[model samples]
Target: MFTNPEQFANATKTLFELQMNTFNALTSKAVDGVEQVIALNMATAKNSVKGSVDAGMELSQAKDPKAAMDTAASQVQPAVGGAVAYGEQLKVIIEDIHKEFTEAADHHMAEAKNTLSALIYDVTKNVKPGSENAVDVIKAAIDNAFKGYEEVTRATREAVKTVEQEIAKATAQVGALKPAPKNEAAE
Candidate 1:
């Protein structure tokens, strides 16, 4: 449908560049997310190691077995709390990445749509008189494709919302849990 070789070449080059840019943006976002996750894990691990060492030292200082057991039991609640906090932090990071990806994709899709429309317009400019029908058909097909893409994008957003709600509910349930009493006598 291109009017000339130069137009076709330019269109191809523009589309290819758009695709490459999109790929690079997405890959960079993924790498940043991975780095954030790794950093979070490293910090968590370091804290966990320190906590264990401190607990061990405390237990060792206890004069009797009962005291040692009590000390160990007392550490359980904080440990559980730490785990819950870690889960919350991880969830935040994941959500951030999802948001960034969605925004970037939306931006690129808009750019691609504009580029395609321009190319189509240019091609249609040189259409032969008898080729009006073909041009109309191409326009209709492109419109339908755009509509389909919009529908899918909406559905995906809704699905992500549902998943986020479920995660929040689960997190709340975990946070609501109460640690076991160390000694019934003390309670």
Candidate 2:
């Protein structure tokens, strides 16, 4: 029934692209959680540093006994250490999340490619003997399928870039806090 080879290629391409987009969308939601974790870590780190610096300054200026400064320093040290640990752990989490998405995408992409190949095989096998028209139809279908894949991939990549930008912004904001003056009395 496939008279136009080009039309068949287009259809196969459309189907593959459609499915790929659906796959990316599902993965993105998962990736977003990782982004949030990173964001939260960053925010925590910034706040910890700011709080520590503020407390240290206040204690140091109070002319509090050496013991008071020591005590405040001791308290701040653990918060700093915790923030550092959390940030590192978050990085590992993001890497793992990305790995998972890549693996899933690879598997689905292979399946879609295989489905295209199978369709080609079926068209070439079951068609009436010496059907030149069928071969042409199959070729056209394959070509269209590839074109669709390219389009969908390009569009989704742009979207992914946008998400990446958002992630970056969120992380950057986490460390944007201004540090307290090293010499408070000078002001």
Candidate 3:
């Protein structure tokens, strides 16, 4: 029990500040992710332009139809490889951001639960005689709420894991389907 109103107010202010700090950290992470994406895009665009120019020059110098076809075939494997690498990098960035956000949120939730529990315990301790049953009921209710929250969080984590596994399987299949070097060599 907070015997003093000032003490309660101070606790409230501290909680508010903690929330603001968490929010700012999340915002900074989001901005950093965006910057990384933009930088990747810019570099990809520059490389693409350079590749196009170089390929054009090579194609122009081709001695015949076979040479032209060979030049074009050589570009395919590199382009496909670059695309796959880019996708993997982008996925990593997204996962990192999500991981940070989840950790921060979990930390905040735990802090809040502890604070509330402590406050409840203090209040119940200071209560008049014959209020033990009421305190028990309050504690039970809080326990049930925590149990429900834990179940939901577990379910959500399992779903996310399932999705990630599916994505990984699909990516593996796509990689396996890459054009065989033997076929490209035959060209």
Q: What tens digits encode model 3's per-residue C-alpha lDDT throughout 54-147?
A: 9999999999999999899888887777666666766676577568656765775686578657756665667667777866775675566556
User: For each candidate, how many residue pairs have backbone atoms clashing (under 3 Å)?
Assistant: 0, 7, 2
Best by TM-score: 1
Better of 2 and 3 by lDDT: 3
| Cα deviation of 71, candidate 3, in Å | 1.0
User: Which digits, one per residue and each the tens of the lDDT, describe model 1 over residues 77-137?
Assistant: 8888987897798789879887987897688779778977887787688899888887787
**Cα TM-score of candidate 1:** 0.77
Candidate 1: clashing pairs of residues: none
Better of 1 and 2 by lDDT: 1
Reference-based TM-score, model 2: 0.51
lDDT of 2 by residue, 1-187 (tens): 3456785677567676758675675568576766778787678769777877877777776655876766675564556455455545555555555555555555655666776676666567656667868577766767576566556656655665565565555445543432333565784
A best-first ranking of the candidates according to their TM-score comes to 1, 3, 2
Give the lowest summed-lDDT range of ten residues in model 3: 148-157
In the predicted model 3, the residue pairs found to clash are: 1-122, 1-123
Best by lDDT: 1
